[model samples]
Target: MNHLSRRAFLQGSALAVSAGAVSRIAAASLPEAVTQTQAGTQPPLTPASGRPYQPVVTLNGWTLPWRMNKGVKEFHLVAEPVLREIAPGMKANLWGYNGQSPGPTIEVVEGDRVRIFVTNKLPEHTSVHWHGQRLPNGMDGVTGLTQPGIKPGKTFVYEFTARRAGTFMYHPHADEMVQMAMGMMGFWITHPKDPSFMRVDRDFVFLLNAYDIEPGAATPRVNEMTDFNLWTWNSRAFPGIDPLVVRQHDRVRIRIGNLTMTNHPIHLHGHEFVVTGTDGGWTPPAGRWPEVSADIAVGQMRAIEFDASEPGDWALHCHKSHHTMNAMGHEVPTMIGVDQSSELKKISQLIPDYMVMGDKGGSMGEMEMPLPDNTLPMMGGQGPYGSLEMGGMFSVVKVRAGLARNDYRDPGWYRAPAGSVAYEWQGAAAYLPSAGGSRPAAPAASPSSKETVVNVVKPAAHKH
Candidate 1:
C-alpha cells in the first residue's frame, strides 16, 4: 500500500465511501503515512501528482510525499516518540512526526488545497500549528483555542488552502514549549504559483533547532530554557551536516527557518547574496541588498538568493562562536594561555583521566580524550588540510563548475590552481620594498629644522 500510486491506493482503501468530505473519512481509509528511517539528505521529491513547481532540498532531511486525490494534495503525519541521531555517534530520544526529529519538510503550491491527517501516538496531546500561514481560524491548531489537542491514538484532520507564496514552519502549539524542545517541528515551503517566479537553479531549506541533552544521555531536557547543549541545523551538527552542493554560476536560494530559542546569524563565504524572501513574503527588488550573512530570529524564516559564481569549498556557518561548538566544551573552564603541565600531573595521580586543555590554544578537535558515551567533541570536523575544529551549525557550500544541473553530490575537495593556495613564506620575514622602487630613505632633517621623520612598516600575518 505504501508504494501504491494515489489512484490505486485510494481505490483500494478499506472503508471507501462517498467523497462528500474527504476529511471525514474513516480511519481505516486514511492515506498511508510514509516515513523515513535513514538519516541523510534525501534527494528532492519531485512532484509526481500535482501542479509542477521546483522542489527544494532539505539539508540532512527530506520532503514529505503527498497523494493527490480529488484535486487535493493529501499527507499523513504520525506523531510518536522516536530515536534521532544528532550526529554519527550520538542519538537522542525525541518526539517527532513520520519518524525523525525536525520532521520531514512539507512542500506545497501557493494555491493548492492541502489535507493533512495527523495521527497522534505520543503519550500526551499534540496539535500542529501551521506557523506563518493564512488559514481559517478553526484550522489554526492551537489547543483549547481553535481545536482541541489530538490525544494519543486519536487522528485529527486539517484542511486548508495555502494562500501565500513564502517560507513557513509547522510545530506543536499544544504544550508548545515542551514538544518543540523534544524536536517536534518541520519546514514548509509554499512555492509561487508560477514556477519561474523567484526561481533558482538550486534551492535548499533547513531549520535551526537545539536540544539540552546531557553528555552520555539520549533524551533532551524538555524543561531547560537558555542552557541548551546541542545546537543543530535540521537536527544535525557539523561534519554530520551535509554540504550544500551547487554547480558553479547557478542561481541558488537558501531558505532557513529558526525554531530554536535564540537567533542565529548565518554567514556564508566566497559569495554575497540578498534577502529575496522572508516570513511575510518575497521582498521587492528595491528592498534587497547584497550581504554575506543574515540573522534569523526565533520563529522566523528567510530565503536568501545568490549566484554560486566561485568554485571552492566555501564555509557556511553560524556567526555566534559558541553556537558553532558542541556540548561539553560550552561549560568547560577557560584554560587558554595557561601552563597546566605540573598541575595536570598532580591531578592525574588522583584522577587518571585528567588532561590539559586549551593551553597554547589546544583544540578539542585534535584531542584523543575519552568522552562519555553518546557525545561529541566541542570543536571537531575533518577538512582536507587538518582538523576543522568546528562543530554545530556548520557546513561547506561546495560550488564547482561542470557539474550536472541537478547533481548535488559532494564534489570532494576543491583543487586549487598552482600557487593559488596560501603557503608558508620562504622569504624574509621583514617587509619588502614596493616593486616600483624602494623609495629613497626618508630624508634626515637637521635638529634646527625642528622635525625629523622615520618610516616604520609592519608585516601582516595571514591565517585561514
Candidate 2:
C-alpha cells in the first residue's frame, strides 16, 4: 500500500478502539448523511444552571465470609414512609437501596478485586447479590441459597474478582421480587486495565425500570408487573431526569442494566455500538461484534461502546414502546374524543405551550411528577422544592459544545438540540430546524458586476 493509504488505514483502526475515541475522517470520507447537512456559525447550547455531568457509577453490597472487605459494599436497604395524596395523605413505606431506590451506579476496573461491606439499615433482613458476576458460589450474595441474611444494623462484606468488563448490576437477593420492586437496583461498569482500551470521550450508565403508580398520585404503587405504569432511566422517569450531555465527535460508552423484572431491548438511532462485553466477561476483540440494538434481560447487564462522532440529539430509549411512557396515558381522553376535544385542540394549536405531550413516539409523562415512592428523596432533591421534573432525567446527549441550532447538524438524524425551555419538541422533530431549514441553501453566487473605475488618485506625484 502507498504511504497515504497506509496512514488512512491506521487512522481507521484507532477509531475502532473499544475505549472512547473520536473517529476523525477526511471531509471526503464524510457519509452521504453528513454531506446533506450544512454547518452553521453557531454552536450548541451550554446551560448555565445545569450541573456538571457526573459519570454514573455503581457499587455492590453483599455479605460473605473469607477475603478482606468481605464481598459486598455498604449496601444499605431502607424502607421509608412517604406521603401520597392518592393515598389520602397517608404515608406508606417504600423499599430502596443505600436509602435510595434505583440504587446507585457502581464503577470498577476489569481484573480488579472488589470488596463491599453492606449494612442493612431497614427493619427487615436483606442481602446483596452481584447480578451477572461469575464468582465462587459462596460469594454470590444469595441469602438462604448462598449464605445467611445480614440482620438489621449488622454489616456483611463480600469480595470477588471482576473477571470481565461490561455492564453489571446489584440488588437485594432476599425476597428478590419485593425488594427489587421497591427500588433496590443500580448499575455497574468495569473498565479495562489498559487506558488505551478504556479511553473514551464520554461514558453514560442507564438503569431502566418501570413502576406502578395509583391514579392521580405522586407515589409509586408496588409490584404490578402486568400493569407497569412508569419507566425510568437510573430511577428517574423522563422529564424528571436530566439529559445525558456530550460533544460532537465524542465517543460514548453506555452500560445498561435492567432490574424491573422485564427485558429491555434498547435502541439508539444514527450510529451502532460495539458489544464489547457481556455478563459472562469481556469478549476478545477478535470476537467482539457490532449491533444497533441489544436485549438486556432482567437482573442482567450489558456494556456497549459507540462513537458520538455524529452530532445533533439522538433518541436513546427502550424498544418496548410502553417502556418509554408512564404506566398509562393520561386518565383523561384525548381532546378529539373528550368533552372539550375541539377546545383542547384549539388551545393546543394556538398556545403550543398548553398542550401536554400527547401520545407521541413514547411517553415521558412520569417525568412531570416526583421520584418514585421507592426512590430516595436525597438524589431527587436537586430541583426546587426537592422534586425532579422533565429535563432532569433521560437527558439529551449533546455531541458538541456551543449553542445547538438548526443549522449545525451531525450526519445522524438526531432530534434538534433541546431548547432552554422544557418540552419544546412536543410536536417538532427531536432537533430544531436550522435557522433556514434542514439543508441550508448554498450561498447564492455573488452576482456578476463590472469593475469600478480607479478612485485612488496618485498622491500629487508625491512631493518629496
Candidate 3:
C-alpha cells in the first residue's frame, strides 16, 4: 500500500476508536440530564437519595435533580439554545442549560462531594465556572486558564467539594459577555451540615438577569452592557414571575444572586430585613443591620431574612424606577404641562400609532398603546384596583395567615378590612406653608404666544 493511503487509514481508525470511547462513556458513566420546559416554578426537590436537608423553593425556577453514584452527588447539565419567555407577550432566543435560562438551582450539603457532567450542544465551545466556589485549581472551570474550553458535542466533568455554605451561582467562563448576555446562569446553594443552622420556615432563590433585545426582536444584542431593555428575575418579568408566598409571622429567607451589569437596590414594602448570608458565608450576627432596601452589586449574592408579619400583598421590586419599565420609554421627550392638542391632528395624519405620554409623568400602566409584534407594553400587569404600572424585577410577597406548611400556590389577592384604606377628604384641601412666603403664579400663555403653537410630533391614532 502507498504511504499516503496508509496514513489516511490510520487516521480514520483513530477517529472511529475515539467516537466509540465517547459513546461508551456516555452510555455507562454519564447521568441523565434532567430538563423542564415550563416557565412556572416547580415544586422543591426534596432530598431523594442524599444527606437529609431542607430543600429550597426557586422563585420562577426549580431545583436540579441529582443522582447518587458511588457516594458522589452526580448532576448532568446540557448546554444549548433555548426559547425563554420573558413575559406573557414576549419571548427571547437565548443560550442556557437543561432547557431553561437561569437554569435550575443546585442544592448540596456543605461537605458532600459533587460531580457535574456538562454536555455542550451549542454551536461554539463553552465552559462552566462554579462561581464563588473553593475547589481544586483544575476544577475551577475557567476556559484556557484552568482547562481547555469544552468544544461542541463534547462532554466534560467537574469535581469538587462543597466547601462553603452560602449562595453561589454558575455560568459560562468562556465568552462570558456573549453567553451571559444571552441568558446563561443558574443558582447554587450549599447547605450547612447542621440543618438547624440558619434554618427558616421558608427559603427562596433566584437570579437577577438583564437583556438588550429590541422591541420586536427575538435575540438579544450580546455586545450591550449598560443600556439593557429587559430587566428580569430568573428570566421572567413582573406578572409572569410567581409571587413569593409565605405564612404570616413565619421566618423567611430570600437568597438573591445578581448577574446583571448594574446594582439592584431591592426594596420590600411593609417589612424590614437583614442581610444574613452572602457568597462568602453566613454573616456574623453583629454585622447585620435592619434595612428596608438592600443594594446588591453586580456578580454578588445576598441572602436577606425577615418575618412575614403583614397580611396583604406587598410590593418587592428594584428601587431604580427605570429598571421596572420595559422597552420604548427611555428616549421619550418630556411634555408635561405642554399644550399639544393643535399639533395632534396634524401628526395623526402622518402617523397612526404615535402616543403622547400622560401629563402627570411618562407612560401610564393603564394606557392601551399599540405595540409591534413580539413586544410587551412599557408598563403592564393589572391589579384588582387598577394597572400595576410595573414590568421587570417586580413581584409580590403574599403573606397569608392560614397557609399550609408546604403550600407554594398563589392564594389570590389580599382583601383589606373596612376603613383601612385611605379615602379622599370631601371638605377642604390642606395647603402646605410655602418656604419663601406666598408662591407667585406664573403668567398664562397668550393666544399669539410662540409657546402656544410649537411644532410637535404627530399623534398616533391609538390613545395613550
The lDDT for every candidate, in the order shown, is: 0.82, 0.49, 0.81
Query: 84-150, model 3: which lDDT tens digit per residue?
Result: 8887778999999888998888999999998888999999999999999999999888899999999
Q: Model 3: what TM-score?
A: 0.86
* Candidate 2 local lDDT, 286-390, one digit each (tens): 887778888888766677888777765566667775565443544555433235456668886655444443334233322332333332221121221122222
Per-residue lDDT over 1-464 for candidate 1, one digit per residue giving the tens place of the 0 to 100 score: 23322345335432222233354557456777767767778777667667888989999888877766788877789999878888777788999988888888999999999898999999999999999999999999999999999999999999999998999999999997789999999998999899999889999999999998887789999998888878999899876788899999999999999999999999999999999999999999998899999999999999999999999889999999888888744556777888888998899876666667777774666666656778877777666665678888999899999999888877677766555666644354333555443323332222221111111112223343
Q: Which consecutive 10 residues in model 2 have the weakest lDDT in total?
A: 32-41
TM-score, candidate 1, is 0.87
lDDT, residue 214, candidate 2 = 61
**TM-scores for every predicted model:** 0.87, 0.57, 0.86
Check candidate 1 and list the clashing pairs: none
